[model samples]
Target: MIRLLSIFVLCSFSLNAKSISSNDLRSLYSKGQAHWPAIQTSDGRRVEPMSLLPVASPKPEHVALGDKLFHDVQLSRNNTVSCATCHERDKGFHDGRTTAIGIDDQVGTRNTPAIFGIDQWQSFFWDGRASTAEQQALMPIANPIEMDLDPKIALARVNKDKSYHAFNKSAFNSSTLTTEQMAKALVAFERTLAAPSSRYKTFLTQLNKNPQHAINSLSDSELNGLHLFRTKAKCMTCHNGPLLSDNQFHGTGLHYYGRRFEDKGRYDATQNPEHIGQFRTPSLLGLMQTFPWMHNGLFDDLAGIVALYNHGGVRPRPRKSQLNDPHFPKTTDLLIKLNLTKQEQADLVAFLRIL
Candidate 1:
């Protein structure tokens, strides 16, 4: 019976290729907004309801062990760095560096992406290299520039810690720790750092009660921005669903191929020429908190970020010598010149702030 109702609600909102005005958006949101669902895009993809992820349901003992492991500097070769050094709880899990600075201040190539919602993520990292959060947990510990400690050595540190024994036995029912177990413990704690609750979620809840009251929750500019986001701004093409990310990668013309800052992004993992310059679409869940933004953390200002996208994202030209190169990275056509007015850009940023 519940399944049937969901189908009906979906059909009701699938207004196909039609203009979605603020009024239509409000009405659709009010009617089928029970779980923050049914706010479908023109392409029929429903906007998923944002929610907290666990590191919540794991046994308290497991989470406690994971928490300890995460903050333990012994995981690093020099015993000076921990996961929290890069992903601070207060700073939206980002360390505020343009690119991460690792052990001995070794600069990494990519920005430290916020770890919120990793359990819900299809892939990990900006390049989508790791398939699971557990796998991701073990990466930084071994990166020469990051922590510079081998996973085996890191686990040995945990095994040597007498205080962690009770946690290990209670969490994994083992007296000795393994590398995989250590990774799982870290992931268990990381999942607790899911996207923070927001006013927009409260607005959706209010909508189910009184549509007008819920509509009143946002200012006129924000409402207009929301409309433009779904319409002219074309952000939904990649940033949609509950997570506000398509969980796919695209070239945004920041590749800087053959230049000093050149990063082949996904191609580094896949080795497929077509994957060059492509980076995974990040979630906008903590939009306001995580900055300077982008895979490289190049843009510091949100307004400037909006301006870049408004102009259809960056499109770097190939060098004269690279003109005939078959693997020249081209920006995805998904980013078209939005032609948004100055007012529209401000409005779009306003809406983005609410996320």
Candidate 2:
């Protein structure tokens, strides 16, 4: 009887241990299967993965030389500004402003986008005109509103520098300085400015191991906001994928300030009537830091942006350039109201802040 009782106790303990292990396995499997949320724009678009070109590390001599050149104002015509002036490290490599202020306090039309993950971008500029980072790097230096330097003249100036000459000989095995070489060095430096680690990235990693773990990691309000962003808010249409940019253009019917602002956006570059009032989508990573949103820096707050979308964007008029769908509901009273309470808006903003 003693032996039988001992056997029964051992059997019960084994069964309970097996059940606990099974529950753990199930939890991990469920967590791993959970899908990460994505964003969408009004135009029914999705974010595309950035295509990156493999870049070889610069020779130690070249990187050292490039670092000096990046900060040198002698490259500018007036010796008043350098790349560092606009792309300060503390501000996510973006000067905090509605638009970039450059040489002699010259104000530019477009906002200075962050340089992080620039190498991942296929096209540069708000217009998406420059196809390569190397090509895009030279524009600000030459732009009259920015560095205000002539490329040929800048190359000549660099050629005159004895330190540059020595570095060039050691790095490139040549003493010649060219506009192309200058652009290459700047591009190389910019490529290294990638931001990879974020809370979202951590979530992804945890999710792969166990989906419950991922969901558990996020705060309750963040999870709620994620549901709204993916479903009702419909932000996933454009702000999809890892980078949260569709790399496409859309007209959100923002008010432009210029008396006769003639900026045709993508239409100016592509000459496609469909592209009028359209501009490239920007990444939402580190968005909490880079503010005064949109291509024109029209909206100052995220709540305003969400409210605009909740209303289905501004109306299109004959003289007023519009980019949103004509068939889509305008922010007019005729459309069904989203009826999102103030707390919901705050929650949505909270989720975006996490991103």
Candidate 3:
């Protein structure tokens, strides 16, 4: 669950044979093998893994400045919050709270996501409001309930920091800085946050060469759960690829009439009725490290997540503005009444932890 993925592969494999339809590629995942799509491009061509993905020149100073800014409370108006306030590094970059609390103890509606694999996200936030990491980085700083630092003040603070100039000179060949450069610096630091190797990754590495060794690594229960995850559970339909996420939004069908507020999710950003109750699919990597899951952190553990899916998520809660709940079951297609036994659910949770 991570990347200072500096190596970049500029290849044309994506333009040729479709990687999505390859039976061999499909087989890699169907047999409980982990998703490492970088092994080949979309055209099924051999491509070297770019070990040094150059994010804005890949300078060491960028990472240093970004780390300082990441934990710097001075970025906040009240000096009480930073990006790390919600996504603390020790907590897998996620705050150990049901919902994030910001400056002045203003509570947010969603759980703080783990930033381990966050740089790879196609969009940022539960609602997909920001399209780039640089854009996403600057948002919470100016959010009234978050860091509460206005963009004008934030720009001035960065521009005025004399200490930042040394790194700025080294990075930009001049002793000056801009808010965009600071955001880029943060992005540079974040790109280094790569997924740490796990038992699953080790098993996956050996699966093609020594299937027996890979099969032997996991217990009977874990293997059984992997089978369920691939087929009956249909988790891979959305939670696919190396990140174990499709990087798209889907509805989870969790609504509560008893709540004092409503989070319309992607609908809030797009104003599209079809997107109601939808949120970005989060990566399954480092799942065990992030407790109290879901966009709202409604569940406490892996078991709760599996069980919720097993029963097809929450039933339609009673209505708020109207008389009854919306009759639409707008959740993902795979979310059905999966009649899984308790042990099967437990095994599924076990497999998730292994990832």
lDDT of 2 by residue, 27-145 (tens): 43344433332333334444443222234565676666667778889878799899888887777677778788998898887778877766557677878878898788778889999
- RMSD per prediction, one decimal? 7.5, 14.1, 9.1
The lowest-lDDT stretch of 10 consecutive residues in candidate 1 is: 1-10
- Name the lDDT of candidate 3: 0.66
Ranking of models by lDDT: 1, 3, 2
Candidate 1, residues 1-355, lDDT tens digits: the string is 0010000000112232235566666665455335333343334444544332334476677788999998999999999999999998888888977799999989998888987776678999988889989988999999999999889988888898898889999998998788888888888888677675566666656766676787778886787665566656656766766667878888888788999878999998899999999999887777667766777777666677777677666788888999999999998776666666688778877887787
**Candidate 2 segments exceeding 4 Å error:** 1-30, 33-62, 196-198, 205-213, 255-262, 271-273, 316-343
C-alpha lDDT of all candidate models, in order: 0.74, 0.60, 0.66
List the candidate 1 regions with Cα displacement exceeding 4 Å: 1-56, 205-211
Task: Report the alpha-carbon TM-score of model 3 versus the true structure.
Answer: 0.79
Best by TM-score: 1
The estimated TM-scores of all candidates read: 0.86, 0.76, 0.79
lDDT digits (tens) for residues 150-236 of candidate 3:
866876876688877787787766776778888888887877665544677676677766665676776766765665565556566
How far off is residue 193 in model 2, in Å?
A: 0.4
Candidate 3 or 2, higher TM-score = 3
